[model samples]
Target: MIPSFRLFPDSASTVSGEVNGFFICMLILCSLMAIGIAALIIYSCLRYHRAHERAIGDQRRYNVPLEVTWTVVPFVLFVGMFVWGARMYFDIERPPDNAISMYVVGKQWMWKIQHPEGQREINTLHIPIGQPVKLTMTSEDVIHSFFVPAFRTKQDVLPGRYTTTWFEASKAGKYHLFCAEYCGTKHSGMIGWIYAMPRKDYQTWLTQGAAEGSMASMGEKYFHQFGCANCHHFNNQGRCPDLRNLYMRPVQISTGETIIADDNYLRESIYDPNAKIVYGFHANIMPNFTGVIQPEQVAEIIAYIKALGPQPGAQEPSNPGTAPSTYGAQKGLAGPGATSISGSEVQER
Candidate 1:
């Protein structure tokens, strides 16, 4: 069982127990060192007291073994701690491939959250337990942070960019959420709750009176509205790189630097368009749509890109009340009357 002690937050995540246990061990080690040093000071003062005014203290200045023992012991302890922390950090940063994706938008005094099924919530988040959930967050205006003490996960939500973080809740319950950043006068009031429910209950909560469309569906519509297909056509020549299957792939930049095309890279390529120029592609062609769209809309665009990639299982339910859906087709992805250039099209050209 996980301990619910006052020294730290409740150990509720998979890594929380291991992390907190290491923390507790370090704390005990430090406390013991402090107490031992204090005791030595008192003992030395009493033993070399000036009660006999003419007593000369022993010149035992350099005990090589004692000095080496203290030095090597702390060094070994520190290296072990560093390795343990590094492994945990690796696990925390890279979410599992089967993890679900969610979006979060931070505003002045509220948080806007969106699930895959297009369920929307303000100042609250609902998630299913025993599954990994990755959250790609951004800010509307200033800087904001998503903090949950129970899950031991906190990531800063910044404007004009994407920050991704993930967590798998170990238990099912309601936990407190706070904006750890001090943005404005109402910073303290920017609080919410994370409800980790059972898987069956979570699916029921998703379909109950909520929108039926997925993020990919909304992103597909946005892709057509912004006229991105004009330059990014399948049989198109040397204008812009084909964006098919671009997520998580490494692209060589103009400066001979290879970087993973993750969420942040995709956001930058859409907003700035000139920051990291592709090695073979020319710059100054794609229009910068920074201020034209909102942060959450960019998230939808990203969702559409990810959906365009290889889908392992069945697709999520689309929005019911909308038009007849032609979703999930990799070819002519913009529906019936369009070119058929897809990721496969890039090779033929």
Candidate 2:
């Protein structure tokens, strides 16, 4: 059966209606202002034109009330618009605490998606309605944009770094997904569909697939497979720094600089170990795995690292000298043949 065409896409997300309303308000205001200016121009031309082609025109200064009205009214409207837009921008940028996390890897002309439950999809995404879904996306090649017109959400996926965006489906239906950026020759073909289903149906869909395991579980396997377990151990007895409770915490480098152990930091540490050395660790101890592993493997390893720690908001040690209670006072342990750094100097702050 043939489907009927519509001028605008369906509003299938929680924020789509708000976004549409704001857009329409702006459009109507601009259109009215344009029409008013055009009408004034036409009226002036007809009412005050030269009577005989040699008629002299009268010089007049602008009225204070008219000038003030135009200036103040636009300034107020513009400030209002700025405030409204900024509020919406922040609301969209910050995902809720309970959002379901999903990973997306964009490369060439296709999108690779992995759910937290380990189900993988290519060019197609299935999300549950009424629940917020947050996507942590990165590109394996050139830049690509993850855009969904119906949800009114778009974010650029860049190489070597992670970009995130979230949206909650309001309606259970299929929505169009597009790579808004001009990627390569097959950019036009880089299109997909988002299926928003009921929570029960979505859970059934997840169970239908033959899953390897959760993303974190898969990452743990990769962590061991890549020989990372040899040097970096969870028990703090390893020659290298401890991996326990390290995610999202500040790490001091050798150069006396502090940086967060975010996804990008983990990726860089794997691909290029020498880029940013941890404050206590020396370089050349960890081998560079630039061409050895794919981006998906790196993501999995990061997931495993994330799993080792308390997810984001756990209470950190108040005392700088005190180590995290997870591994219990072993924060500064350096076994035999370990590169030297005093355990006391590795501050959790």
Candidate 3:
């Protein structure tokens, strides 16, 4: 049975416990301070009442020790509080290395979430009860906040940048979520619910949600919709790598060294493609889809690559023989990563 108001959600991860403890401590300290201040105010009013007031000489004067003590004590308390809060903040922001990642886009009226497993939701988040879920979120237009009060986690999602928030729900239940910030006219309607379910139930939800147009399928749809095929197709005249199976594949460099095309590499290739030039591709031709594709879509694209079953030999570029010619040496077009790649020779393999 669930209680009416829970101070803390079920503890599933290490940081939640610390967060709960810190929250409780804060509540206790605040309560004590409020009570003490109230009591002192009442006592001063009664003792120093005008009817019973003494002469001017009998009143207290400035005390250097008292002044210093008041200032120093508060300073120390604030510093300690800051340090304690910072520790918890850092731990919560930086999730474990193996934490499962999810992408959330805070829009004007709703929260769009894309699970790593291809499940998508609108204003409803479904997370595994005991798994550490790291949410990489950004706002589409204005500043927004992703908040889950029960889990004691909230993160600002700003446009043109990325921010992350993470938490692990201990017990399986439905919890309320809100956009703690006053965003706009529909801010009140931006409320949502987080469904924390058992691991098996979460898996079942993923499978059920992915029955149609899964992440990979949506990615493929977007890839085609965005006209990526015009320049990325093997038989086409484009100067970019084929989009068949780019993720997790060894990208051969000019120096003959092969580096795995991992997530960072792929992300760089998307927003700032020329950062690391593949052997045969021209960076300038690849447009930065940062503004075009939402962060959620980027995650979907990555998910599609992960689901592509194995990179087949047919997915390899057909223009491998033209590797020596750095197509990126000259500016091809005004695209996101192309500006950097132009006139830059391929340095590493």
> Residue 39: error of model 3 in Å?
3.4
lDDT of 3 by residue, 21-112 (tens): 88789889889989999999999888867663553435577899999998998799889899999988877776654467678888897999
Model 3 Cα shift for residue 109 (angstroms): 0.8
lDDT of 1 by residue, 269-293 (tens): 8899999987777899999988876
Question: Model 1 compared with the native: what TM-score?
Answer: 0.80
- Tell me the spans in candidate 3 whose CA falls farther than 4 Å from its real position: 1-16, 51-54, 57-59, 213-283, 288-295, 304-349
Query: Clash pairs of candidate 3?
Result: 253-349, 284-338
Q: Number of the top candidate by TM-score?
A: 2
**What stretches of model 2 exceed 4 Å from their correct place?**
1-3, 311-349
Worst 10 residues of 1 by lDDT: 319-328
Of candidates 3 and 1, the better by TM-score = 1
lDDT of predicted model 1: 0.77
Cα lDDT of candidate 3 equals 0.69
TM for candidate 3 is 0.67
Cα-based TM-score, every candidate: 0.80, 0.86, 0.67
How many clashes does the backbone of model 2 have?
2
lDDT of 2 at 88: 86
In order of lDDT, best first, we have 2, 1, 3
